[model samples]
Target: MTSDAQVLAAIINALGAPKKIPSHPPKYRRAAVAIIIRIRPDHGRSSAHSSKRRHRQQPQPQAQPRQQTSLSKQPPHAEQPSCLDEIVHPESLDEFFAQTWVQSGVFEILFIERANKRAGDHRWTGHVALPGGKQASPDEDDQETAARETAEEIGLDLADPALFRCVGQLDDRELWTSFGRDFLMVLAPFVYLQLTPKSPPLKPQPDQVASVHWQPLSLFLDRLAHPQWTPMVINLSNKLAPRISRTILRPLFGTMALHSIEMPYKPEFILRYQQELVKDTDMHEKAHPCSFSHSHPPYPPAKTRTVAMIDHYPDWDPGHRPLRLWGLTLQMVADLLELKDGPIQPDIRHKVWDSHRMRKRLDAGHLPGFSQADMHFWVRALLKFHSWQQTEKNKPSESNRVGSWESYYRMVKQAFVFVVLGRATAIAVLVRMLRAPMFRMIQSSVPSVRHSKLLK
Candidate 1:
């Protein structure tokens, strides 16, 4: 078993030599996200206090004043210190990880659940995501954009060297709409490691962030120890609704299988205004007459209530439903974990779409919500589609440019046409073959109907 230090060392090394993707043309917007990592004492463990004491005995670095960056031009209140900074200026990341506290502590990554807002980008609303947004003007580079967004969204000043340091960066990713119809932006992910013993208290902006959470890194690295990943059935009909009506797409592509990990950490709600709204609701209920019998109990107090409505929207109640990590965020984590032969759980790693693998998995009953025969048929059809994609890759066309919007759009269009035609043809053929058997079975079951005037 690899120690956390060894794993983190590998990550640092991988990030140091990242395969960087150049920014696209000015037409494409750029965005950045910060993957904030920290090591905190496992309070649940008995040796937590002892570990802290041992950490204190180690040579402490002199605290230098945080340098003012362009991001610091914002209001002073945003930059106020919220936690004691126990900074460590290690000669190397290996030395940093070798610290007594780090070795004993639990590694954690920060995540924020976006508030469900009616306006703005509805695609990411109520999603468990990293603190980030589109790059604004005054930003020198993508890293600055990530830092500024992090501070604005969650009050975590990544620019503050006293509390955190930018360890390295991951490869850039191209954002696309469903079925790759349109290019949204290029997302550059930067990795930051907390220097303090305890993380600074986060003040999430209620309008943007619903809540903040720190999930243990172990959950992603070890699957057997923590079995959180489960199959999540996505309604493909809903995903295709923008292009085609759900009524038409429902029967063709009902659902698609994906994996999601249940978040274990309890979210600290940032929207304190919800409590006031809950209070108003309580007052309204008290004034109104009861619809039920007098014996029915009154509603719980606003203070006692576990859930509250905010902006006429229900906040993500973890108690009601566990927050699941999936989609792009999960993919980013997978990419980070796979760096330098890190101990990332095999199941969570990305797998290319292959017919043979699909068949093998289907036969072993690994894939749920799909029949063996249906998978076999679809896999065969997809093989042809895959071949076409390879052939196109070899050609010297403008659309052959990988990760370009035009190329992605072409592939999506081809896939859409292929899937629709294949499904329609398969359904038609099945119906035709079953038609004769159905007539024979019906005649045998209802002899009188066969000889009746209706049959004639």
Candidate 2:
């Protein structure tokens, strides 16, 4: 049987070999992330790998004392070599099964969600992203950037090469931002195995981070794991009634983009809340806040207003609460898992491309342009049409409340606060500007008073 040390050594050796690294253009922005792996002891003895190892290591009964045969003389049995012979062979080492090793034992990686979520162009905000950021000048290279960002973001200091071993680099992929900042961003993913099994408590940077997630590596390797479709409705209703109505349907005035998302089920790595006694009912002390009780229905069920103000949303399956993973993060994970095709379904890719082309066409004036006045007219028309439809059906639409008196009152209160704040800011600026000049004038008058005193 191969010792655990031998298994780890084999992996380290395979990672040391040169890989076919992809080249990127200089104009593209470069970023890096560490695929941190924590190898745990394999507890499942029934696994094929474990069974094979057991079968190979089983002791064989000593050959029965050879009896002299009357007619035949059999050649003495060839000396048998240790199983470790194959593992130590240089050629066999080259063909070593990395997937078997990685998938054999229980392992997991770290993922983080960004805070201060921004909307529109920067749709990736608030999404689950690997602990990484854009490269800085202080970073000597992409690897350094990945290590430094990991330390800053998750408090994992990979700077010491002795602690973390680079498993190998994954193929580089380029992401050209279509919405927010128009630029080409390149991703360089570096896979790393934590040499030290016992890691320190993670201290995630709060301002830049919303939460930390530990994802099991097995989830990625699961072929059955598929991506979920998300509907993103871009509000193109000019600047007047922006964020009014959104739908997957091609808007006569707005745009609808379908974003491909893959949110795998929660792995065993993430710690769940422990059930505790609380007064009467059994309660979990650390329940997931975003999740709800089994009996209670999710509030504002998305289906209730699919075509209303909240058009941009994801389709969550029952018991499949997603972590909102999409965009570049999805691509990186797919690559790390050695997925031949990318994470997004091929058909979904076509739809997304079509949406992008549609957006481009609208921007190019291929469609009728909408003025701010036209947007306002559409807003009122939509409100009236929806109201009339509800009356005809004799049913109350939840979306109707978006533009109701209560909503208007809230809007008015927000506007009043904004006005008050704006006026106060302007007054403060004006006072600051006058104070400097008034101080100078007072200094000049003080000189005149000093002259008068000298004459006295």
Error of 1 at 416 (Å): 4.9
Q: Rate the local accuracy (lDDT) of all candidates.
A: 0.64, 0.49
Question: What is the per-residue lDDT of model 2 for residues 1-456, given as tens digits with 9 covering 90 to 100?
Answer: 123334334434434322223435666468888877765534342145545755688886665656754235644432222222122222332343332333344566777767653334454445677888788889888889899999898688887654565667655544443232234666677877664434556766655665566665545444224423454334442211223333431244344233434445443222222344324122332343444766654343232211111111234345865675544565455444422222212221111112222221111112122233443344344445545654676643322111122232233334334444666798899999999999999999999999999999
Kindly give the stretch of ten consecutive residues in candidate 1 with the minimal lDDT sum: 396-405
Pairs of residues at least 3 apart in sequence or in different chains that clash in candidate 1: none
Residues 1-456, candidate 1: write the lDDT tens digits.
126656777878766544455667744589999999998864334144444554688687677556744565778765342222233666666666655566667788899988866555686676889899999989999999999999998899899887888988876777766655566788888899998777787766767888788888877766423444377776656654565587776665656566667776466554544322344555646765672557544664455343333332325554566677776787677667656464222221212233332221111113334222453355445546765664565632221111322232344345556667777898999999999999999879787765695767
The lDDT leader among the candidates is 1
In candidate 1 the C-alpha lDDT for residue 143 amounts to: 94
Candidate 2 residue runs with Cα over 4 Å from true position: 1-29, 46-55, 61-103, 117-125, 171-175, 179-181, 196-200, 223-321, 338-456
